[model samples]
Target chain A: MKSDFYEFFCPVKVISGRQALSNLPHEMDQLNVKRALVVTDKGVAGAGLIRYVEDAFQGSACSIGHIFDETPPDSSNVVVNQVAELFKQKNCDCFVAVGGGSCIDTAKGANIVVTEQTDDLMKFRGAERLKKAMKPLLVVPTTAGTGSEVTLVAVISNVQAGVKMAFTSDRLYPNVAILDPKMTMTMPPKITAATGMDALTHAVEAYYCLQKNPISDSLAITAIKLAMGNLVKCVENGKDEDARLAMANSSLIAGIAFSNSMVGVVHALAHATGGVCHVPHGVANAILLPFGMENNLAKRAGEIGELAQYLCGREIPGDDRAKAEAAIQAVRDINKKLNQMSGLPNRLRDAGVTEDKLEAIAKVAVNDGALIYNPEEVTYEEALEILRRAF
Target chain B: MSQSSNKNDSRGLDSGGLAAAGASAASIYPKAKEPLGMNRLFSLSYPVKRGIARVALLALGAGFEYLSRHCDKLKEEISGWEEGRIFALSILSQGPSVTMKKENGAIRCVGEDLKNAEIVFYFKNIDSALMLFAGFIGAHTASAQHRTIVHGDIGIAMEALRAMNIVQSYLYPGLVLKKTFKRAPKMSFGEKILKAKLMLVLLPGIAAAARR
Candidate 1:
């Protein structure tokens, strides 16, 4: 299953298990960092999860220079600028991102600003365009979704311009990704369910996208299997350390897979929804995964059929097309189960996406860069249809 | 959420908004001194950007020439192809075009004349072309993204795509080939020797071409 020609790169050092957070100071010391700026939201700090990270730094050569716990749920250019200022003011030489995607991306954006000595990040937007390596960054993701830790791209909203500028580069990969069960054990079941589904969408899209290759496909399959086996258990009992660790590993694996291969219309549509209506990214992705899978079924039935067995835990009896439909149905069943367990909304309407905004979301989705990797050509009207169906 | 009427926002600059800024980037030489039609600012410094594109395109052309001469895959792909078959790879609405034509079963660069080109792959923007040359994105993915347009026979375009893929297999490292190609070839001992020979000659030839 080797592709004719393909390249795979993941330079991020990963450490996962109990008390993985304790290695953060040692990892930072290896990177020769002296002072670190910790980026997280008020919620993570309020939940006392940041205490573990703070405790990890005690007696280590690497010290916390500042704790900027003001990141909003949605990362913005303003937050990035503020974080950069804090880094400079505190004379921090490294970043410790200790929350979900927003905090991680905010640190990434600020890293670009400080290292590149530019106030504006938009100049570095797009793929592999940066010239200088970002300052050392280590991510400890509190949520088991978004995979922002290992991903090479960061999305920061520019509310003034009404656009979310995406910055991508090989240099953006965090120097280390530390996954600790204690960090995610405190997440509400709803957030847990939504983020786990986000990981699933990333895996499914990586397998079916145009950039699919053997290596990425292998990682994606493993991620899907892990998610299928552990996401529900983690949701049902958040304290189950094994389930939490598996889900964490699944999110990281899926992150690496999709970051290399890229995601498709599901991300495009979900990103647009997050932009227009302020829906949570994972929630939007969770609602739209089945609809997006159905849209791609025609061009990618063989891959979808294979996915059916991974998801449903049994061989489906049918042709490729029939099995693809069965895979889509398995996703729908999973969504319902998540809803029953954690009250995760299964439809756009339930997620608070107004009908009037579907057209706007469709318009933005068609222009998303993710559309380039989609198996099928998606038009604005067709995107609208998917939205309506998901609604 | 009030919209600002000012010409620029805090997100640095969008290519489309540059008309008001008085810094328009024109293509390299042999074309009009007008701004890039697609309006993307070249991210690299101008001298470095132009030099990189020139050398990369020259290497690509020389690689094709070498493949045409020594590679069996190339021969099989273009076997029975009529003479005077020309293909141009160009960024749409700009310069830096490279056209190659089949002459006596070998490929040679024909400069930037579209009239002789039966097939042309046009990048929608300068950014897209630069990204492709930088190996940041694959050709097939670029096409799917509407970043490219093919002008000519659909059948020939498909053939050209296959041929380009073959040349790429010989030119790029196995790792890059694995990333870019749908299926990377398993090279034989002779094929590996041929690729080594091609690289030895192609690198200097591209350097010479770029100097000119």
Candidate 2:
């Protein structure tokens, strides 16, 4: 459906396949990169997935200048500053972000600081603030989820301020995303299930959020179908290359979809919950997706109903309202199956959300920028109600 | 703002001499004779558009003052809000920002310069603001188009949006309200009297404020 006015853009050149990592050096040549800084977490390096990125650069003009593998699960501003300093010290011409969202976001934040020549990223926070073109960044996500390689926004936690600072600008989009299935093949069942569900949530929210338009709607539907078909198989059998590649594509497509259309209350609440209790982002989304949809059902029932068709692979038996309810049920069923198969958390309490912190989480959730894109207005009381229900 | 206006006036007129000459020779020039596209129409001398926006924001501020004083719904919605809570609605990098504050239990405009606004509603482009100021679209519709960004506490922003909706219900006609509001206000008999009373007080007050 067409809105009266809307804007959509995704400029990241995505290269996906079994041997896609081999194309990284050629892509680097396209970006005119020489020495590259490799950013990854200890977890990804431990899994030996960094080798795929390192090995891709062999026999090419571009070489890895330094490896900063200390990225935490939550990328922090302090870490970003350190990475930028290292990039400058090594005289690296580009960044090759490995691992998931945190590594990618750290590189993104560092890129802004390096190119803009600002020591404090706090001054350049918010949307469309960075005006200059950043150094070329090529992302090789070790996980199938987050899709951060293509996203134009980065969330880096400020350790001093105890807040997550989000940097959004067109300049943040990486020059290339090399999705090699081998990189994600090392993910365990639990991470696979959680990340898959996170991609599913992204597609679902993008399909029904206030910003939904024809282009995003089409991409979101395809992402939903791809994720629903491949997430379970990939979780059950991690070495299933086809399933891993499919889920990777789903995550990438869903990343593009939500990047343009944006997510709704689910992401808002999930972000707050993550900020408060340190829950992983994908697990929070996996826990809260259905509940978030239920909250918006009143205003977006017809749209939610349409998602049931994607999930069920057929027309659901009911009117728009009933189909919407069925869609909620379908999400619940998927959650249960994912939990049974891969031990993914199906409730907020299971995800370590304490009952006492619900009020605080609710207070913070209401302030998230994503709330502006929610289909229905969410008040504090309503946010608390959703938290309690999810709990 | 004035500095930017002077710069624009200089650039748009290509120095004062040509601008005066263009005004005099506007009828003879083919470029001047061309039908104005939407962008061209809005690209009127920046200072003039900026002036229109200032008046529109002031009028909107006065409208909020009336609604805050007379509308019981708005009062109830904003009840228990802090005394000095500030909000800013702006067109980013183009138009001026309008700041509003809660003073003496009602929201009123402070000035064009944004102070310590706890909440900010930003339009990414001036075209979005133009469409909205021209009443071609409503707040919810604008939001749907990804034309608005809320900075600061979103809960408080929603409350302010609700208050804006209440003000719109009273300020615009039923047809506009029907399109804009999810559930347009159905005023009771006493509420109708309150609306009438508020309008009687507002017209003179708005005129005075606009004049000043």
Model number with the top DockQ? 2
Superposed model 1: Cα runs more than 4 Å off: B1-140, B143-212
**Chain A TM-scores in order:** 0.98, 0.98
lDDT of 1: 0.83
lDDT of each: 0.83, 0.83
Worst ten in a row by lDDT for model 1 chain B:
B25-34
What lDDT is reached at residue B48 by model 1? 62
Give per-residue CA lDDT, model 2, range A100-202, as digits (tens). 9999999999999899898777656666668898999999988877879889999888788666778777889999998888999989899998899889999
Give me the overall lDDT of model 2.
0.83
lDDT of 1 by residue, A1-391 (tens): 2133345779999999999999999999899998999999999999999889989989988899999999998889899999999999999999999999999999999998898888877556555557786789999999998899999888887778666777767888999999999999999999999999999999999998876776788999999999999999999999999999999999999999998788999998998898788888889998999899989887789888889999998999989999999999988998999999999999999999999999999976766767767777676789999999998
In model 2, which runs have C-alpha deviations exceeding 4 angstroms?
Answer: B1-52, B63-87, B92-96, B101-108, B114-120, B124-127, B134-136, B149-178, B182-212
Error of 2 at A187 (Å): 1.5
Residue A62 lDDT (model 1): 82
Error of 2 at B13 (Å): 45
